[model samples]
Target chain A: MEDRFEISLLLDFYGNLLTPKQKTIMELYYNEDLSLGEIAEINDTSRQAIHDLTKRCYKLLLNYEEKLSLLSKYNIREEKYKIALEDIKDRFKLSDEAINYINKLFEDINNS
Target chain B: MEDRFEISLLLDFYGNLLTPKQKTIMELYYNEDLSLGEIAEINDTSRQAIHDLTKRCYKLLLNYEEKLSLLSKYNIREEKYKIALEDIKDRFKLSDEAINYINKLFEDINNS
Candidate 1:
C-alpha cells in the first residue's frame, strides 16, 4: 500500500506481462487505490486472498523490473533528453521556441 | 523463415516478456536461423511441437507489440529525435559538436 506509486509505474511497463487476474488485482489495488477488502469484495474473493494476490502482484512487478529494467531505461532516456536540452541551452543562443519544441518532442516520446 | 529479421528486431523489445522455453526457441529459430527440426532436436521436442511453439511465439510477440506497441513507440521516438535535430540545424547555427551530442543521446536511448 505504501509502495503504491512505484507499483503503478511498474504496471505501465510490465502490466501486460501479468496474468489477467494479476493485472486486474494490480489495477484495482494500485491504480484505483482500492483497499484489499474492497478489491476482494469486487472480485468476490476473501480479503486474505486479495492481500496475498496484491503482495504477489507487487513481487511479480518487482521481479520483471529487476530482470528487464525497462523502467530504469525509461528514466535514463528522460534524463538524457533533459541534459541534452540543457546542454543545448548552455552551448548556444538556442531560441526559446526551439527549446520548447524540444520539450514538446519529449512529451511526444512519453505519450507513446 | 523470411520473418527472421522482423522477429530479431521484436526480440530486442519483447524478448524478456516471453517464457524461458519460448525465448530459447525464438533465439534459436530466428536469431540462430535454426530450422524446426534443429530446434526440436536441441530441445528434445517433436518437430511438430517446435513448429507449433515457434508460430505461437511469433503470434505472441505480435500480440504484445499490438497491445504495448513498445517497438512502434521506439520508432516514433527515433523519428522525433531525427526531426528535432534537423529542425535545430535549420533554425540555428547549432554547433556540429552539439548536433553530434544530440545524436549520441539518441544512441544512448536505443542502447537502453
Candidate 2:
C-alpha cells in the first residue's frame, strides 16, 4: 500500500517540532507562500538565517519522523477509514448483514 | 511559542505520508510499541525492511515538514488557544472588558 498524505498535512504535523524561528520561517515560506526575501524582511532577520533555519527545520522534522512514525500511520488510517465510511454510506443496496458488518468495522476502527 | 505536541501526535500526522508497508511497520513499532523483530514477523517482511522502512519514513516525514508547516503551527496554536480559553473560563472575577476581549479572541481563533 503506497498510501501517502498530502505534503501540507505533513508540514502541519511536524512544524511545531521546530524552533520558533524555524517555525516562523517555514510558515512564511510554505503556508504564507512568501518569498525568502519577504520572510527576511518581515522577521528583520537575514535571508541567510531564514534559509539556514528552513534547512535545519527540515532536517529536524526528518529526524523526528525517523524515530517516530505515528503521523504517517494516522494519516493513512484516517484516509482509509474515511473512504470506507463514505463508500458504505454511498451504497444504496447494502443488505442488513452488510450494514451490520460495516457498523462493526467502524466500531473496530474507532476503538483502534 | 515552542509549543510542541507529543511525539506520538507528530507520528500520527506524518505516518500516512509513507508507503503502506512503511506505514504498517511504523504502526507496529511506534503505535503498537512492538519490537523490530516482532514487526518483521507480523508483516512477513525482513527485519531490515522494518528498519529501513522506519528510517525512510522518518526522512520523508521530515522532508514534508520542511516543505510545509501546518502541523507545527496547528499544534502550537491549539495548545495556546486551549490554555487561554481554560484560563479565561477559570477566572471568576473577569471584568466585562476581559470577557469581551476573550470572546473576541476565541472568535478570531475559530475564524483563523
Candidate 3:
C-alpha cells in the first residue's frame, strides 16, 4: 500500500502479463483505491477472496520485477540520459534553446 | 529456431523469470546449441520432455516480451540515442574523439 505508486509503475511494465482477473482486481484496488470489501462486493466475491487475490497480484508483480528488473533498468536509463545531457551541455556548451529542448524531450520521456 | 538470436535476446531479458529447470534447458539449447536428444540424455529426461519444456520456455519468454515489451523499448532507446548522437554531432560539432567515444558506448550497450 505504501509503495502504491511503485506498484502502479510495475503494473505499467508488466500488467499485460497478468490474467484478466488479476489485472481487473489490480486496477480496482490500486488504481481506483478501492477497499477490499468494496471491490469484493462489486466483483461478487468475498472480502477474503479479494484480499487473497490482491496479495497474489502483489507477489506476482514483485516476482516479475525481481526477475526482469525492467523498472530498475528504466531508472538507470533515465539517470544515464541525465548524465549524458549534462555532459553535452558542459562539454559542447549547448545553447539555452538547445538545452531547453533537450529538457522538454526528457520530460516527455519521463512522462511516457 | 530461425529467430535463435531474437530468442536468446528475449531470454536475456526474462531468463531469470523462468524456473531453474527451464533456464537450464534454455541455456543448453540456445546458448550451447545442444541437440534435444543430447540435453535429454544429460538431464535424464526423454527427448519429448525436453522438447516440451523448450516449447513452454519459448511460450513463456514470448509472453513476457509481449507483455513487457522491454526488448522493444531497449531497441527504441538505442535508436533514440543514435539519433540524438547524430543531432549533437551535427549541431554542436563535437570533437571526433567525443563522437568515437559515444559510438563505443553505444556499441557496448548493443553488445550488452
Best by lDDT: 1
C-alpha lDDT (0 to 100) for residue B14 of candidate 3: 87
Give the candidates in order of DockQ, highest first.
Answer: 1, 3, 2
| After superposition, candidate 1 runs with Cα above 4 Å error | A19-21, A93-97, B19-21, B38-49, B93-97
> Is 1 or 3 the stronger prediction by TM-score?
3
What ordering of candidates by lDDT runs from best to worst?
1, 3, 2
Worst ten in a row by lDDT for model 3 chain B: B103-112
lDDT of 1 by residue, B1-112 (tens): 4467777888878898799889988898888888999888988889999998888889988887887777787888788778877886777667788788767866676566
Using TM-score, rank the candidates from best to worst. Answer: 3, 1, 2
**lDDT by residue (tens digit), candidate 3, B1-112:** 4488888989888899899989989988998999999999999989999999989899998987887776887787667767766875787677888777666654443333
Q: After superposition, how far is residue B90 of candidate 1 from its true place, in Å?
A: 3.4
Q: At residue A34, what lDDT does model 3 achieve? A: 91
TM-score, candidate 2, first chain = 0.63
CA-lDDT, candidates in order: 0.81, 0.60, 0.79
Query: What ranges in model 3 sit over 4 Å off?
Result: A104-112, B102-112
lDDT of 2 by residue, B1-112 (tens): 2112343455666665666777777777767788989988988888998888777776776666665444564555555555544554454444555445544533343333
Q: Model 2 residue A77 lDDT?
A: 49
